[model samples]
Target: MELITNLPVLAAILATFLLAGLVKGVIGLGLPTIAMGLLGMVIAPAEAAALLVLPSLVTNIWQLMDGPKLGPLLRRLAPMQVAVAVGTLLGLWAGLLPGKGGATAGLGAALLAYAAFGLLPLRLPQVPPRAEAWAGPLVGLLTGLVTAATGVFVLPAVPYLQALGLERDRLVQALGISFTVSTLGLAAGLASGGGFGGGALGGSVLALLPALAGMALGGRLRGLVSASTFRRCFFLGLLILGAHLLWQGLH
Candidate 1:
């Protein structure tokens, strides 16, 4: 990959992944979101997406296996996972993904929405047990579409997950499960679009080192920092980044 050969870009990639992983380690999420948003400013979103696959997949898998309630979570969330895969593939088929030039705007829109959602004190109604059947698939489908377009998968999915009223540990595990599926779906979509070649895959593998390192560092620092304050700063940064990307795309 030219990105690997280019010293400056390679450095950027390493730094970005390190920071992204740190965020995830501290907050239990935001690796993809932070990585994609930052990298998109420096490269094509498609390339950024390609480089995200391995680190995201590996981390999410680690996260997914950490909790003991996998069986029950899978049973409850299986339909949503399937729908996520289908919707991602369908979005790719419809050419809604990043390489198309319009995707920067799509990504910007997604970031703006996500950051706003995080920053706002919006309370979503709790989803009843009976509503899971219909609600899960619907949210998954929407999340998949956003993922396909932006290479970031935290929108309706996160909001919907929060509304499910799961216990704290179960909620974290559920996020891991959902993100793992989304990452896989995104990988499939990227491969089909010729974006996930050997070079990209290699870069992704290399990127994992920094990501893991950052996660470790962040894990140690988690107790030292206030999560709520850090999260506010994170969302503010995303809001600014989103505005810049939106302007860049429009021009």
Candidate 2:
């Protein structure tokens, strides 16, 4: 594949990363989600994920470094993270199936689903702790499958987290930790498959620099927006992106 490193494409990539980072900075968990949603239209899902990996990791590091102090919050969410990681592997396996388009379709569907749910008045029922165990496996599988294309996995968990009444800080922290593991897992899976090298990977890594810069800038501006306003605007953006992806995939 020919890499587009021309000045205009480079500028576009930087702008996209900045938008993604700004969204994440404002919302606490949308850097890759926003970036991949937008970028997947222009690049392969795997490539999009690869590009966002570094930025997601770098941004989340600060979020998670402070997470250790939130003991109860960490304890409650750790299991879900474990489940997402496990499910991601299964998703990857399914993704690798020849011509199945499991990863690509699943990623797009998950994003659409997440965006739609976010826009609606959706809530999850509280299950007993034992039943809660099942959520991890399901989410993991979904995360893995979706990661193959868009490199974003937390969509499956969004509703659950929103319903859990988690404060913004805890939710963001949990997401950061979840993505940290997801990114590492994806790297390992790609390595084993001998994927994501050559110009594509280099381009992705280079793209990550601008993404991080954008996120940093956005994080700085996050305080200016009211929570409710941000929430509304965020969902609207997701809705638009989701519809666009669905159209792209179906056609």
Top candidate, metric TM-score: 1
lDDT of 2 at 191: 53
Question: In model 2, where do residues sit more than 4 Å from their true spots?
Answer: 68-76, 96-105, 127-130, 198-201
Query: What is the Cα root-mean-square deviation between model 1 and the actual structure?
Result: 1.0
lDDT scores in order: 0.89, 0.67
Q: What is the TM-score of each candidate against the true structure?
A: 0.97, 0.85
Which candidate number has the best lDDT? 1
Model 2: per-residue lDDT, tens digit, 1-251? 25455666566667788788777767777777787777776666666666666777777776676555667766776777666666566656656521235444555676777777767876777545666566655665566555654577566666666555667677677777777777776766665565656665677677677767776776777778787788788878877777777666776
Candidate 1, residues 1-251, lDDT tens digits: the string is 79899999999999999999898888888999889888998888889999999999998887789888699899999998888888888887788777576788877888898899999999799999999999999999998888888888888788899899988778878889999999999999899888899999999999999999988888888899998999999999999988888888888
* RMSD each, Å: 1.0, 2.8
